[model samples]
Target: MDLDNLIVMANRIGLFFAAQPDRDEAMAGIAEHVKKFWEPRMRSQILAAIGTEAGAGLSEIVAAALTTHRAMLQPA
Candidate 1:
């Protein structure tokens, strides 16, 4: 998938989890959703984008979730 599309999807997930009362849980929820539903290649591409200018488009919560749960999102 394209990086922009990935960002949109991740941000959408973040939007859903943002309603959670606990910030940590929200981030974790975002990470878990990505980890569970996205394929390894898609996850890898998103991870790479997270370090680049394209990543700036990501929502604050999505960026935080990507940063905080990076290890878990990495492909084996």
Candidate 2:
């Protein structure tokens, strides 16, 4: 998937998790959702995008989740 699509999807997940009462839980939810549902390449592409200007398009929550839970999102 393209970077834009990934950002959109991530933001969508962020939106869902943002409704949670706990900030930490919301962040973890975003990471877990991506890790569980997105393919390895999709995670890799998003990780790469996180290092570039394109990543600026990511929502604040998504960016925070990406930064806070990067290790979990990595391919294994």
Candidate 3:
């Protein structure tokens, strides 16, 4: 998985989740229903999108990562 592509995808997923009425619940649903099913590399890519920098808290990044993981699992 390309890290940059994954980040872009994750950021998009984050934006989508952020737009929802219940952000935290959406994040949790994603973590529970999606992250577990993702390929290891895809999971890593999503997590990488949530940077470890001080400005990007781990929890927030994890949320984005999980959301992205879930989105990737969905069929078109």
- What is the lDDT of every predicted structure here? 0.92, 0.91, 0.54
Q: Show how many residue pairs clash in every candidate, following the order shown.
A: 0, 0, 0
- The true-versus-predicted C-alpha distance at residue 56 of model 1, in Å, is 1.1
What TM-score quantifies how close candidate 3 is to the native fold? Answer: 0.50
Q: Alpha carbon lDDT of residue 28, candidate 2?
A: 95
**What is the TM-score ranking, best to worst?**
1, 2, 3
**TM-scores of all predicted structures:** 0.95, 0.94, 0.50
Please write out the lDDT profile of model 1 over residues 1-76, one tens digit for every residue. Answer: 8898999898889989999999999999999999999999999998888868978899988888989999999999
Please provide, for model 3 over 1-76, each residue's C-alpha lDDT reduced to its tens digit, 9 standing for 90 to 100: 6665555655555555556688666676556543555566676555554545521433464456464555554443
Off by over 4 Å in 3: 29-37, 48-50, 53-76
Candidate 1 Cα misplacement greater than 4 A, ranges = none
- Candidate 2 shows a clash count of 0
* Residue pairs in collision within model 2: none
lDDT of 2 by residue, 4-50 (tens): 98898899999999999999999999999999999999999998887
| Comparing 1 and 3 on TM-score, the stronger one | 1
Report the number of the highest-lDDT candidate: 1
